[model samples]
Target: MFYERFTFRLIFKLLFINALGWLLIYLILKTKLWFTIAGLSFILITSVYTLYSYINQIRSDIKRFILAIKTRDHTLNFKNKSTKGSFPDLYNSFDDIIKTHKDIQLEQDAMFQLIRTILQQVPVGVIVVKDVKDDAEQMEIAFFNEAAATLLNVPAYKYWHRLKQHLPVFTAEIAHIRKGGKRFLELKIQDKLIQLSTEVIPLNLYGADYTIISFQNIKDEIEQKEIEAWNRLIGVISHEILNSITPISSLSDTVNSMVANKEYLNKEDLEDLKPALQTIKRRSEGLLGFVKDYRLIAELPTPELEFHSIGGILQHIHVLMQPFAAAKNIRLQVGQTSSKITVNVDLKLVEQALINLVTNSIYSLEDTENPLIEIDYRLEQNKLFIDVADNGKGIEPEVLEKIFVPFFTTRKNGSGIGLTITRNIMKMHYGSLEVSSVPGEKTIFSLVFNYV
Candidate 1:
């Protein structure tokens, strides 16, 4: 205000002085006019200094605004008191915008923190993948808690790419369930069987599609199932074996008593007695074999761990079974893995289990044009899984559940001890044997060893 008024005063003073000079010129008409020129030069100097000061103030305000933005202080304001003629309203509007954005940012931060807290507290694995919009991709990982990180094996800085490869199989499965709108799925995760549930939602106010996959470990459930199966098996075997043994013992004792009585002996009677004795003997032998099979389960041998390569084992088995398979016109193929893997296992027991599996596979391949048997091994999450698969007329779904039980057979001439003994061997080694079959497609017997 002072500078503006001074400038106005100086202009007026210059006009007055010029008018005075003109008046003098009109009256005196012969002076040099040096005093008027000096006064005008002083005015010009003062105007230049004031203009430089105003320019400096404007520059400083601009620098402050930039600094505020860099420091994330969006609410910072610069209302230039010196900028004259209608600028306050504009500055006020700009400040309002900054305040609004700052408020939004605070709200967003709060929401993220709350979500993070919930995820960290969750017991089950919680995996999240956010959609990347610019590339029109399905999802990327926006957040992963500790449980999720360990479950998915996600490493720092490589999370996005890792998620890209793995999450789709889970997401697609989840999406299918969501289409039906089911809440849960029985799944296998890292050698541990589990049930997983998923929810699709938007993340971070950006409308990125996020999937939350939560999984419950079902290891205990599977253990319970195995226990139930064994309990039922024991009950049936005990009842049936006792029933057969009681009558066989009683008949043998009666035959011995008749043979000892000389007074009742006759040719016709002796002939009938001989047939009866022989029938009893044959039944006794059959019962003994049955008891032997049953006792194998009761007297299971403890496993002695030995390091053995699967490839060598399979190669040896393939050679041993080659002639048998060739006689039956069956082709046995060994699938290769990345490298040779040595596992701590009982060699004899594992071999016996695998032989039973291969035998079962061969028996199932009756009517197929090309009976193909495949033996493959894989390492997932540091667990070794050996799969014996066959292209055969697979077992019916209704009977698939009972295939592992002792003495349960659909075949006419089968003792049904192969798979039962196989399961026992796996149990001794603290491993699992799982059978999956689809009619007319394939039957897979997966022997899993999670020691490593």
Candidate 2:
């Protein structure tokens, strides 16, 4: 409809001009006057020029509108001055289209800003990667947040090829994640455990497919779960053993008292019964002590958190263990990396934990020549660590895994609860105990405190 309207108007203007030209020609021919011809010629030329200028003006307006749209200059407005013609409506249409496009562009920009803000604020590490189609070994890191760089220990704008050199474990894990159906994994980097979850979005965004990877630190969560399981098991075992042992202890005492009384048995009967009764009494008492240790494990008190000087704590431990160390001619020494270091912990519990580690070290050094037990405290990466190191016969690998289990002990007379209690104490303080040993060389037990 618009095309037809424009074409009809153009044809009418051409026909009117043609008629005017014919009139001018007839007047010139009939009058045989040069003045009349000149006047008509001027009028005809003026009319033709006016028509050309009007068409050129419309062409200029169209070119300006195209340029404004191409440049995204939505502020440009086309004014309709001629209210009597279709040019007015054409100008109005152009203005409306430009306004609509401006609104759409503003909305899109706002949406993009919102998305970027959300991605930046999220705690979990996120990285978006796009696989290259032709180059199998090349992958582009399209986006990565601050947490991603910190967690991977790599630059935020690194390609997969370079990232592999910095974090081979992470790159290898991510490669396996790209294979279908594996979305979660636990990776250890720089002695810190990280839990990773990946999602392959399979998005055809701007003609490419991309994958989004996410990472969470779940080490604390796993440790909490293990602690809960240990508590429950200890609770049940302690309850049952106490119930059985209490009655046996009482009965053994009663039987022994009766056996001691002459009226309770004859001489021969007394001789045979006394040893058996003594055995029963001894075993029941031992069982009672064992149950008590398990109960302690199950009912470990919550830490009374307070900040104490690391130097003071280590000095106390060294003094307390000196006599025992000297009895075996073993040298026990304590030192610190810094004199002003402090730790937040339960004083009694943390001391006990350290005592257990030091005692274990002392015991391990009994047979070695020039046996030494070195106790030292140091600050590393904002963490406080107390190490009990010994040049002793270190633990075997097979025994190391079960060392923390309750009632698992290598020493014949050990109650087997010392290390277990130490571990529990560390956990109560939101800390951890780590041990490293080399057979016939050295053993180091580190009590790591995360408190500032």
Residue 143, model 1, lDDT: 65
lDDT of 2 at 314: 85
TM-score of each: 0.54, 0.48
> Could you tell me the TM-score of candidate 2?
0.48
Each prediction's Cα lDDT score? 0.71, 0.79
lDDT of 2 at 215: 74
Q: What lDDT does model 1 reach?
A: 0.71
Model 2: lowest-lDDT 10 consecutive positions: 176-185
Taking the tens digit of each residue's C-alpha lDDT, what string does model 1 give over 102-186? Answer: 8888999999899889887776676665556576353466666777666545552224555546656655566654322324455
RMSD of 2: 18.6
Candidate 2 C-alpha error for residue 220, in Å: 14
Pairs with backbone N, CA or C atoms under 3 Å apart (clashes), candidate 2: none
Please give the lDDT score for candidate 2: 0.79
